[model samples]
Target: MELSTLKDAFDRASKKQKVSSSKVQEVIDQVGREIESAILKLQSVDSDQKSIFIDLRNKLVEISPMSQLEGSQKDLHIGLSKYARILEKHFNPDISKAYRNVDFDSHTVNQIIATHLYRHGLSDLGDFFMHESKEPSVIANAALKLQFLEMYKILDAMRSRNLEPALNWAATHRDQLLQNGSKLELKLQQLQFVEILQKQDKKQALAYVRGHLAPIASIHKVEIQKLMTCLLWAGRFDQSPYADELLSETHWDKIIEELTQQYCSLLGHSYESPLSVAVAAGFQGLPTLLKMASVVMAAKKQEWQEMKQLPMPLDLGREFQFHSSFVCPVLREQGNKENPPMLMPCGHVLSKQSILKLSKSSSRAFKCPYCPLESFVTQCRELHF
Candidate 1:
């Protein structure tokens, strides 16, 4: 909503500028025409030279083009002042207000930055950064960098319609991909089959399907049937019923994303780099943090940086929420490793500390806080969030 208001303000300022420019141009043209008329009158005069000079001077004074020009310029200046104020009101250029001081290990910070750079295929920058930071360990351990480099190489090949590398990767990781409920191998072969069919090579397409796609046909019957039907529209798949689905560039993009996700999974990392996720979450929460900081300062309260958590909740989007969390209703505290949530046999949940206290640190029966059902401490299992 604030972005929309800023855009509207920008539009108004732009419109005002255009109007001011047109007004100034009109005033200049009118003044030019009056001066030209005065010059013509002076040129056509047949009277004595002194009389003609006096009449021309009087006409120039009557026209007063300088005053008109000044009025137009004043309007333009007023419009410019309003535009400046609008920009100042809508845009907050100083982000430092949202910043908080925290003690972070310089080495750890550098490692995270270097990893982010490498994860995004900026190995050159990553290497240079590690070199400058004097972090030999990061440079020496090239496993992570090599893994991402291979992923990038496969993605680069996919961009050029060369699926061989990706297909080979999928084939090598077929078992793991199937374990993760992935159809990447089948998808890659399907793309290959379509590519062959697109070239009017039905015989080779059939041969490729038999050797590569037929094995997965039993598992993905519908998908395989759709691909097989494409044989009738060989070299003219664009006019086929499946054109919208099979011929879209979106398929290539989706396949690339899938491959990257699987590759990252195999590497024991999230699809997005941890550093990138943290930065994105921080960027989204900055405005709220800044507003809170202002209020805290106005109230003469203690520094927010000293607090473990914010006074209010930050309304981050669903994408930022990566996992489920549990807060014990009995103690009104969040679950942690030391005081983890426990699920009672009766279906009620409470913190370990709460259960221990209720059961007097023994395996005795106690009434559930949330329900009338009773259960023994031993019957409660620790729940992981």
Candidate 2:
């Protein structure tokens, strides 16, 4: 594995490992080895990208404290910049003195410059020079470069349609935008971010549906067909909990019909038999059986009953022949008719019950005592004799 991937796997393992002395020591040793290997790989990266990452990391660490200074003088300057037109409008001379006393780092200077430019509608440094400013600007060239980089980041985010992060970055740099017209930048930001929340995160999606989708469905305004698609595909609802909803809800019927039709195409008329479709769909046991029953019941009652009343069909040549209605269920052959139940190789006589038992047996060793063909029982086929 690559050093980065190995480190990532170790980090994940560390997070999930049980709290214990052995586990802790094992993880510590693994991480120490990983870090040593990573350091060797780090030597091979281009110097400029490495320096950039290091500088960014240091800046993040330095600014970490500023986030905690709520209700302080620095907060007034920073927070007011989010809405106000000018730094002078929000900044107090006394607060400036206090800020100077605090030994502000390069990060703080960058932040101040970024904040000033952001509040004035000058998110993009390129556009800041277009509108001649009446107020004297004290922004350093380095700060402008930082602001330009930030604006570039927002632009990239806009192109990717990540509106939330772009909006967040825009809000932080609101002062820069108003003073300088970033018309093109703002236009780019206006592109709507499109996403289907259904597929984002399954747990979050389920929670959203339970909390939001269900209530909306109750009100009956939107077409939530895809939402039902997500639910059924996920198998989130069981027979009991979703029974009433599927029975009465118009949306669910469409989902069931579509799913059933697809299954029927794959499995043929046998699809109506719950066990057959369930097995074909890869659902085992009670849940599959329940879903199969639901599909049948949800189908048109007349059509389904007509299907059920039809006799057990036999494939004869190119056509399917349904046995006559007068045929006895307990008997495999119609008595006094040309057809009669016949035995196989060993010469024992029986009906469909015998064939069914052998075909459905889980054991491969199942041999028809009547026939020498051991384990050659074709499912529901008549004896050739």
Candidate 3:
């Protein structure tokens, strides 16, 4: 099911849960009130079991709602169970056919996950995992940049509405941030200016703007003007035209995200964990891979690893796409540096080996498979990405 459908199912389940809980509480309260009334009557009158039983029987109608509560609770349970099953069915794809036996270095995989954890500031857990794995070559410090981890810690603080860490970082790396053309530092300062203004300290806020924000005024003239305009709102920035800029928490989120990305870039690390990126790409192509595996198994003539390239393309979105690739149709081979793709005179492309073979070792002019144009071996040009 789609995301919206899944959300709708969850909503229905939540509603059912609430209804059941309320009904159960209502029944309990009713029973409590009746029991209290019966106890009071017994204390006022004769303390006999017969008398208590008679009183309870007279007020028994109050407890009749218990049956309705039971029915409602049962129906809600059934509905919630059905909803859970639907969600499970929607998420679980048929993967039995996609299973393949391949040798994996479990140790290396563990190291990658552990390293990923370390990168994300889960050092205690990473240390535990590393020690448990007991691999001498897989020290966390080997791949880690101390500064990068520190930067991540700062970003984490920024996410928690603590900007001091980020401010200190920006101050220390001012030149580097400017070198990278990062707006994050300025954005953080702007947020601080707004925060100071939020406290109704316009004087300090103005002083901060002039002292801190003015230096970047050349690069952010329009933004500085907007901030200056926002000063008129004073303690009521929420009612200002720049309310979206001043009152929203998402700006902090954006700043933190950009800060992390820029920090990684400055430290020569990827913005995302390599293992996470790989796993995401794998999931994106999993269904297609499963189908391909099934087709190969059914045919019983080929193995997936035997192919020069995949029969179909795997679209793992723009983030995963890094470079260009070309496969030669004539030779049924992928273009490589040694045997690079070449363009024919007729606008057709093939690998160098394919051109040679099609042209009878370049003794004769090679006719394009796609057209009637022919070209000499010397005429073909190598293609580059």
Q: Pick the candidate with the highest lDDT.
A: 1
Estimated TM-score per prediction? 0.81, 0.16, 0.61
lDDT of 1 by residue, 1-385 (tens): 2778667767776776787678768766766776676667667747365765676677667767678667766776776687677666545567787788888999889988998898899999998998999987643449889988999999999999999999999988988999999999888888888888989998999888888876677888888877888889987888999887767999878988999999999888889989988989998888777777777645767676677777878988989977656788878888888999898998888899999899885667888877888888888898876
Clashes of each: 0, 20, 0
Best by TM-score: 1
Model 3, 130-222: lDDT tens digits are 778886644345557356568777877776767889888787888898888787777888888888989998888889889887667888898
Task: Let me know the TM-score candidate 3 reaches against the reference structure.
Answer: 0.61
For model 2, how many clashes?
A: 20
Could you give the candidate ranking by lDDT, starting with the highest? 1, 3, 2
Taken over the whole model, the C-alpha lDDT of each candidate is 0.82, 0.41, 0.79
TM-score-better candidate, 2 vs 3: 3
Candidate 3 deviant stretches above 4 angstroms: 1-110, 137-149, 304-308, 325-385
lDDT of 1: 0.82
